[model samples]
Target: MAKLTKTFIDKVEPPAEGYAIHWDDKLPGYGLRVTANGVRSFVAQGRVSGKAIITTIGRYGLFTEEAARKKAQKILQDMREGIDPRAVNKADAAMKVTLQDVLEAYVGRPGKLKASTAAEYRRQVEKTFAKWAPLPIASITRDMVKERHAALVKGGLEGKKAAPASANAAFVTLRILIRFAMDEYRQADGTPLIRDNPVDALKHHWAKLGTRTERYIDRRKIGEVWNKLHAMRGEVQGYEALASVDLTIFGLLTGARRDEMATLTWDRVHMDDHDPAECWWHITDRKRGEDLQMPLSSQAVALLRSRPRLKLADGTESPFVFPSWGKSGRIQDARAPMQAIGEIAGRHLSLHDLRRTFTNIAMRECLIEKFRTDLLTGHKPASDDVTSRSYLNLTRLNEWLTGEVQKIGDWIEQQAAIAASKNVVPLQRSA
Candidate 1:
C-alpha cells in the first residue's frame, strides 16, 4: 500500500502484464489502478452485503489526489452501509449526460427519424437551446424551462424578435427530448434519471400558436396575388429567385406543402401534353409518412414544363424541380417572393396558406365534396368517419380529382383575367 500522493502515484510503475492497484495507506478503500496500457484511474474497493465491489471513480488527471480521496471516502461509506458503490457511480454518470448527448443519440437511431425531422431537431437545438446543450440533462429544471419559455416569448434572448409560436414549438421539442431521455437513461436502482419532464411546469401555460386556418389568400385578391408572383419572377435577377416564384405558384395551384413542393423531383412527375387529365405527381416522404399522388391542374403542368433542366457543373441536371445553388440542392423557402405576394394579398401569407386557398376554392367556390376536397388537400379523413377510413380508396378517383382541380384552376384564371382587365367585381354567388 502507498499513501496515494500525486508524486507517489505518478512515480509508481505499471505491472509487466495485467494491472496493479496502489492503495492509499491514509484512506481505507481509496486506491489508484494502473493498467499495463499506461492508464491510471482512481477507484474504491470494498464489500457490500457480504459481496466484494471495486468501482472506478474517474480517471487520474480528471480528479486530483485530494478530490479522488474525498470521492473514495464517500464510496467507502456507502459500501459500509450496504449500498453498492457501482450503482452510485452509474447513477452519477447517468445524471451527468448532457443535452447534446441525448439529442445526438435520439437522432442517430437507425430509421427512427426522417431527414427533414432530424434537420428540424438540429435547428431547434441550435437556435432555441444552444445555451442549454452543453449542460447536464438532469440540470434542466421546471423553473428553468418556465423562465426560458417566458424569455423566448418576449424576444429577450440575444435580442431576437418576439416569437411566441417558435417558443411554443421549442418547448414542445424539449418535452420530446426529455421524454426520450427518461426512457433511455436510468439510475442503477432502475429508475429514470429524469423522473419528470421540466417542460411540464408549463402544463396549462403553453402559448397559443396562431391558427392558420383563416390565413389563406382572400378569394377577391387571388388574381392580384397570382399576377404579382409572375411579375416578380420576371424582375428578379437570379435563377434561385425564379425557382422560388415558381415554387410559390406551384404550391398555390396544387395545394402542396412548402417542403413537399421544394423537394419535388422530375421523376415523381407524370405528365402527358396530349392528355391534360393524365398529369399527376407523387410525394413519397410526406409529413404523414404516407405516399400522396395528386392530379395536377393544367396550370401546374405548364409551370413544371417551363422549369428548365439546366445542367449543373457536375454535368448532371439537378433532381429538384425547384433547384438551388445551395448545399440542399433545392430551394428551402420562397420568403422574399411570399412577402411580395402577401403585400398584394393584403396580409402576411405562408406557403401553407396557399394550401388553404386551394381548399377554399375547391370546397367553397367550386362546391366540391368535402371527401374529395380532403383528398385533393392531403388531409386524412376525420377520425370518426369509419366509411372513409376503411372503405374508401380516394386515390383511384383521379378523373374526379382531375376535374375538381381544373375547376379551381379555371376559376383562378377567370379571376386573374377580370383583375387584369381592370373589371374586378365582388365574386358573384351565381358564378
Candidate 2:
C-alpha cells in the first residue's frame, strides 16, 4: 500500500475479470477500486459495531484524491464512534435527492399505475418538467410554482406559449408528484420530509385560467362527419389509415375513448358467440380501472370483420385490433386522420368529440335513457344510492344496452345514407 494520489490512482489498471483494490498507506481506510469494466471509484473501508464496512465515496474523476481522502477520514471517524457511514450517507442522499429521483420512484412503484397512465406521467415529467428535474424536491417553493405556472401559460417550457388547458395539465402533473412525495418520503423521526406542498397554490391559480368550453361535433353536422370519414378512407391507402377510419367510426358508435379503442386487442373482441346476445367487445383495461363489456352493433361487427390482421416479423399475427409498425406495436394516435375528416365536415374535432357526438345523438335524437347512455359510455353512476345500483341485473341490462347501441349505429348509417343521396345530381333533359 502507498499514498494515493491522482498520479498513483491513474496508474492503477483493472484486472482481466472481477475487480482489484489499492489501499493508501497514509490514509488507512481510503483506497481506489478498479472494476473489470475499467470503472474506478474512491472507496472507504472501516469497522463499525465490530463489523467491517465498505462505502464508496464517488468516482475517481468526479472526486479528487484529496477530496476522497478527506471524506474517507470523516467516514472512518464516524465508524470508530459506532456510526455506520452507509446509513449516514443514505440519510444525506435522501435529503439531497432531486425531483427526477422522486418521479422515478413514484412511476416504478409496483402496481401503483396503469401502463397508459405511467406513460403519460413519464411524458409530462420528461417533457414539461425537464428543467426542474435535477433540482431537489424540497427546495421547490410556492412562489416558484406560481412563477413556473405563469411561465407555462405565457411561454411554455418548450419555447412556445401553451394554452390554458395545456398549462393546467402541467400544474396537475406537478401537484400529483408533490403529493406522492409528501406521503411516500419521510424523515428519520417519522415526520413528513416535506412539510407543505407548493402545488396547493394551484387551487387559486386555476380560477384565473378560465373555464374551458366542451368541444364536440354539432348534431346537425353528424351526417357530414360520417360522409367525410368514408371519403377519407377512400383517399388514404394501407391498413393503418383504413384502421383509423374504422376506429373513429367505432368511437362515434360506442362512445369509447381514443386510447380504449386504439389499444383494443383481438382477444377482447367477441365477434361470434354461441348466443348472438353474447357478442360484444370486452374492454378489460379502461381508464376508470374497470372491465366494461360493450355490446356490438351490426355496423361495429362489420367494421371489425373487415379489418385486416397484421402479421409480425416472427410469422405470427399481432393481437392488437389496430396494429401499427410503430415501436408500441399498436395505433398510438388517430388525431391526425380525425383532424383531416374534421376539415371536410367543416369542424375541427378530436377523438373525444366522436364520443360526445355519440352521447348527444343518443340523448337528443335517439331519445335513449340517460342511465343507459352512462352505462354504454362506461361512466360512473350519477346516484350512488344502493337501490339504484342493486335493482338492475347487469346481464339483463346488457340486452338493453345492446339494443340502444344498435339504435345509435342505425342512426349514424341513416345519416350517412342521407348525405350520400344529397350528393346525387338529377339530370334535366335539354329543352
Q: Which candidate number maximizes TM-score? A: 1
lDDT, each prediction: 0.84, 0.79
Candidate 1 displacement at residue 285 in angstroms: 2.5
- Could you tell me the lDDT of residue 386 within candidate 2? 70
- What is the C-alpha lDDT profile of model 2 across 1-431, one tens digit per residue? 87788887888778999999999998888889999998999999999888999999999889988888899999889889888777676566667878898889888999889898788787787777788899989888999888878877776666563445457777788888988888876664456668888988777786243212345666666777887877776887776777877788788878998778988999988867455456688876655634767888888888888788998999999899988887778876675567766666565556776788788889988999898888888876666657656676543335557889889989988877776785757678999
TM-scores, one per candidate:
0.82, 0.68
Q: State how far residue 346 of model 1 sits from its true place (Å).
A: 4.0
Model 1 regions lying over 4 Å from their true place: 1-13, 22-26, 48-51, 61-67, 82-84, 87-96, 135-167, 182-212, 287-290, 382-400, 424-431
Clashes of each: 0, 0
Q: How displaced is residue 377 in candidate 2, in Å?
A: 1.0
Report clash pairs, candidate 2: none
Best by lDDT: 1
Residues 193-235, candidate 1: write the lDDT tens digits.
9898999999877876546777788898888887887788779
The parts of candidate 2 lying over 4 Å away from their true place are 1-88, 95-100, 126-171, 182-213, 272-276, 286-290, 341-349, 382-388, 395-398, 423-431
RMSD of each: 4.2, 7.5
Total backbone collisions, model 2: 0
